[model samples]
Structures are given as structure tokens and as C-alpha cells.
Target: MTQIDIKVASSEILEKYFIGNELPLEAPVETWINYEREEKGMDVKMKSFCHLLFYSKLGSQLFDSINLDLDGSCCLIGTTILTAVRIAVDPLTEVVYSENPDRNFLKSNNFSYGIVVVGELPYSESVGDSTNLTIAEPGYDTITNVCEYVKCVVIIMSGRPVVIEPYLPKMEALVAAWLPGTEGQGVSDVLFGDYGFTGKLARTWFKTVDQLPMNVGDPHYDPLFPFGYGLTTIPIERKATQ
Candidate 1:
């Protein structure tokens, strides 16, 4: 049987004993052997059995268990459950402002005024490993088309800077949110004005791939966005609801 099948079988066996019972937090190895022999009509001396303790909760909890391997050796293992919480987020409304408003296009066109473009570079497994610095295929093309329709904000999530100079002119704003992982609420907070935008570009954003191996203080050193470049904005206060 596969590992998943084993786990499922183990869980099924354990669930009957776990639910609606005031059993002790830990059970002895002998107890498991007795339970298996009596409940399933098996001879403990002839066959080996596996015992697993399953815990499903939101916070930290300790569990102790012992398994009898095929070689008649005892193995002890501990399992713990970590943090789990749900976050409630409100629906967001999109509003866009242009330098010169187009009334005719706004009435006829169904295109959105505000857009967010997420782009990334080729992923690498190792740190400091060299990979393609250019934003890959479909992402580059998608950003180009979206920017042409309306001024959009582009967010790049990667370990290092990428070549985005071609799409800079059309993009209204650009954010470098390097690998936020599971903390996406933090990004939405800033985008929705709940928080302010006060981040600065740590690395020099090059214009093209030809500028590889470029750094600060190098001769003819020019970049699309220089190091330590950031824009500051004030947080918008949420109005009280009646």
C-alpha cells in the first residue's frame, strides 16, 4: 500500500477510539498491542502493528506514541500542531484617475481603469544562483497589453531585480514586493490605502540585459530606478459605518 493509503487506514482505525472519549493524552505501547489483538482478532507475536496518534487543532499540543515495526523494534515519535487562524477581508472597489479623462471611452469601453500586474523571474532552487534576469514570456506580454489599455500598477515578486524598462512608461506605479510568501494581506493593505507605501528599491533596477554585472559607482553607471528609490504615502482612515 502507498503511504497515503497507510495514513488513511491508520486514521480510520484511530478515529473510532478518539471521538467522544475521555481517554488519556498518551497510551502505552502494550495498550495498543492489546487493543489490536482483541479488537481485530490478531496474534501480536506473529505480526507487527503500527500505531499513530492524530491531532487536529489550531494551536500547539503535545502527542506521544509508539509503533511496533516489522522487526519487533519499538519506535517513538512526537507530533505537534502549529498556528492556524482565519483573517476576514472586506470587498474592495476599484477607482482610477487619469491626467486627461476620456469621457467617450469611459462610456463605451468595458475595460477596467485600475489594474495590478504581478510578474516574476525564472525561479531558482539555490540562493545567489544565476538565472534569467528578464521577466519571462507571457508575463512580459500580458503587462504590455494591460498597460496599453490603462495606467496600471506592476508588482514584481522575485529574489532579485528584473528588466522592466520597456513597460515602465505605460505603468503608473511599480512595486517591488520580493517574495512575500503567505503574507498576501500585507500587500493588499498597502494597495487599498489601509497602510502607506514607504518601500525603497534596495537594488539598482537595470534597463536591459546588456547591463548585466552592473553595480553602483561603476563607470557610466545608469539605472532605470536607482538604489534607495521609494515613494511615501499617507494611510487613509477608514470611515465609521452607521
Candidate 2:
């Protein structure tokens, strides 16, 4: 058996080949070697090492023909739902953040529609997991109160399934936006009809916590939303603003 010192190799690779050198873009197999020789003064020993790393089967697979324009493309993606909703709806739409949200304002404004974002906080091993699957604290109460004034499209942002059966009757639409991370603009893209909703459920959503162990094949399986359940919508193109 042989034990290779990866740390030593990594340090050597970084210091010798990678340090102060911009990574070469997608090009011919000899691009790195040419780049090293022409752009940065190349050492013979370093050239041989780079050849070994670049010309190998794995290295060829790793670096060949990658789209270097991905960062620019991502930058052109949609804006957040908050910004989109405000632009598409009303620029003066009131923004409220409170434990006890004011229902009086909702009634007074008489808005046509509302968006409710409910979710569990980000959890880790040290702090432990959420015990309840229902929307926590003021979120559920707030959503309930808001629905009384205007129809709402609720977006659930948890990493796991949440109990939303109680609020289903009042909700005009529901979206399971499980952990969107930094690409919240994608959510807005769908919400604004720039893109269609094409996602399906990966797991069965139970009506209550009592059905904890239930699955798709269970004899007594009575799911609020069955596995693979999803709704689709056609993309609606927006006219360009003059």
C-alpha cells in the first residue's frame, strides 16, 4: 500500500504552478503550457509537471470546453420576488415586518392580492432541528389574518415538508420554494410568469404529524399532496418598456 502526501502536493502545485497565474480558459490541450510559457515566464520543471497534470485523462475531462461566461449569464438572471412583485403590482405596496402584522392596513388598502412567505429558520446540528412542521409563531397567524383581506399566493421556504393543510382553504395559490439560496430571482421569474412552474414533489406531504412514517406505498397512506404532484404554467412574455 502507498500513502501519498496530498498536502505537500497541493502546496507544491499552488506555489509552483497556480500562484499569480490566471487559470486558462477553454482551449486546446496545450493551452496551459502555452499560457505559462508566453504569459508567465515558464520553468522547464514546472512545464513538465503542468503537462502531466493537463494532458492526463482526468485533467482533460476536468478543464476542456467549460463555459467561462457562466458568471455573466448568471448575472442576467431575474431579480428577487420582492422587487418583481413591487414593480409588477404597485411601487407603493406597503412593506410590513412585525410579529403582529396590522390587519387594519390590509383592509384599508383593499389590495387585489398578497404574497406570504413562511418558513423555518436555518438550523444546524448544534442548535437542533425544529420540532413542529407547522408555520412557526406569528407567520401562521399573520397569513390567516392577511387572507381575510385579500387573496394570497403563499410561498413556503422550508428545507423540509411543512403542514399547510389548515391554510389551504384560504390560500389562492401555494408554492414550495424549498431553500432557494441566492437564486431567489428564479422564484420571481416563475411568479411573474417569465418562466413556468415545472417542479414536482419529491416526497409525500402528510396531512398531519401522526402520519410520520407514511410513504407512497403505505397501506394507510393518505397524503395531503401525493408524491410527484406539480402544477405547470405556460410562460407569459412581458412587453418591453419603452
Candidate 3:
């Protein structure tokens, strides 16, 4: 988390004065082309912001038990949880109940209102157009197992939506923080309830890749989540300003 913090902060400074917005030092198109060609940037800042939002099966139950309200609380976030890290142990177990003391700290407070933010870091250059829509190995059961014993907020960091049907039944809350650009504080900003969750889903999340090609004339059009699928901390109808 600290590493993420540092990277994000620095990226914002760069973005403010150089990359995206109105800044005098902003690079020109020719310079931009060269920069892209070289792929020059920080990985943490490059990451799009995507975190778990709303709640799944464990929704009301979780909000009631732990203080995981739109309000805020301490939480844990895991990364790159695809394959099993230990040959003798389940990969999901490695992440959920790993030897990591931080995980243990949150688990200890499970019944007492502990909050663990956990999920996978799935990425690809282009969304649907590119292949590799799979959620990988043990990632399928990560939320189910973790939520069984701990109060957790799941985050899926990806450039595009991936299948989430299986784990939906157990997840309390999930956020889709697309590669959050170097503003790590935004993660804490939302987690701590400093600000309300205002982002929405940009793509459809399917139950499985088998239901792919979610386009016109595609026979299998059933999606776990459809396009424009999104939720906000404040109801759209009641927001101060829509």
C-alpha cells in the first residue's frame, strides 16, 4: 500500500504538469509519440483505478456486521492472485489466510468488524477485442473463501471486465478500479469514505468466457452483468447533483 501511495502521488504531479491536462510544459504530439513508443512511465501510476463497489450476496449482511458502510474503515488489498503460490496449499488460502501478518490482523477482527480488501489484478491492452478473458486459476474462489471467515471488500483491477459470476454469491462488496493512474491516494480516499463511490462499469462482466462475443447476432448473449452496469455510494436519484 505504501508503495502504491508513493507511485500514485508522483504520477499525479507528472500528470498535472506534463501528461494529460492543461499545463504549459505538456509534451507535444511528436514528443508524445516518442514517449509512447518508448513506453515511459511508472507502473503504479499507469494502473487504472478499479475497486469493488456495491455488494453481492453478502451485501446487507456485511454492512450490518462490520462498519463497512459507505462511511469507511481499515481494510486490506491483495494483488496478482492468479495461480497457487504454494504447491501444498490452496492459492486462494495463501492470499486469504496467508502468513502475512496484515492478513492475520484483519482476520483476527473478523467477527469484530474487520475489513479485508482482496482481489485479482487482471490486465490486458485492449478489452473484448483482445483474447485472454479468463479469470485464471484459484482466483475463481478467492472471494468465497475469504469472505467465509473474514469481512472483506473485493477489488478487481483490470483494463476491462472479466467473468465474476461464481464469486458473486459470496462477495460483500467489489470495486472495478481500472488501472488507477498514479493517484494512489484515491484508493484510500474511497476506502476511508473520504469520498463517495461515483464510478460506473464501462463494460459488461460475463459469468464465463463461454458467454463471450456479447455482440449483435451472438447466440449466447447472457451476461453476468450487462453494459452500463454500475452502482454509486449515493443513489443516482438522490445524489446532490446527478
Candidate 3 versus the native: TM-score? 0.46
Across 91-183, the per-residue lDDT of candidate 1 in tens digits comes to 253333332334454445555544444556546677446545765557676566566776567777677887788778878888787876544
Q: How many residue pairs in model 3 have overlapping backbones?
A: 22
**Candidate 1 off by > 4 Å:** 1-109, 125-132, 238-242
**CA shift of 39, model 2, Å:** 40
- In angstroms, the error of model 2 at 47 is 32
Clashes of each: 0, 0, 22
Q: Write the per-residue lDDT of candidate 3 for residues 94-115, one digit (tens) a residue.
A: 3333423343444565352223
Off by over 4 Å in 3: 1-132, 136-138, 216-220, 235-242
Question: For every candidate structure, what is the RMSD over all alpha carbons to the true structure, in angstroms?
Answer: 13.1, 14.1, 16.3
Better of 1 and 2 by TM-score: 2
**Whole-model lDDT, model 2:** 0.61
Best by lDDT: 2
